[model samples]
Target: MNSTLWIVRVVLAVVFLASGTAMLTLSRARMIARLGAWIEAVPIGAVRLLGALEVLAAIGLVVPPLVGIAPMLAAAAASGVFLVMVGAIVLHAREREYLQVVMNLALAAMAVFATWGQLAS
Candidate 1:
């Protein structure tokens, strides 16, 4: 169970980190080309905010627990990831991007399970 949770956390962290970094670094046109119309649906400020949160959450998911201090932060970060994915699902659904919604759902489920397993442990 612990191993499973670690695996999930690492995967989530890697994904979020890459996504957040892209959002932070990419221009609107670049993002639009890569991510489709959903980038235009939200304000640039909101995108930056979400990107910041994701990057922080990614770091939070790994650092505290790995360093053996404030391990509860790992669970908290997992929960944060779940919430972020929930928002992603909402945005993707609103944009009629069903495929993105499904992907978000899977990631959200993994985030939830990771949080649950960590909290239980």
Candidate 2:
């Protein structure tokens, strides 16, 4: 279970880090434009900020655990990802993008599981 949880943490951390960086830097304009049409929501600046937060969380997930400096950071980072997914679900729902909502929910569940496992161990 510990090994499985570690693998999940690494995979999720890499994914979230890469995706968040892309969203923050490369895809900011496109994302904001698409999301803007819905609720004038998620300003460009806010998107960038969120992206930064994700990157930080991604680092938290991987670094502390591997370095043996408070493994709790890993769980906290997973929790942050879960919170971000929650926001994503809400944003997608408001946009009437049901597919995205489902995807976000799935990601949130995975994050929650990872968090639970890390904290448990």
RMSD of each: 0.9, 2.5
lDDT tens digits, residues 2-121, model 2? 788878788888878876686676664566555444334656677678879988988988899899999898899999999999988888898888987887888898899989998888
C-alpha lDDT of all candidate models, in order: 0.90, 0.81
**Tens digits of lDDT, candidate 1, 3-109:** 88888889999999988887899998988887678999889999888889989999999898889899999899999999989888998998999999999999999
Stretches of candidate 1 off by over 4 Å are none
Model 1, position 4, has a per-residue lDDT of: 84
Give each model a TM-score: 0.96, 0.85
lDDT of 1: 0.90
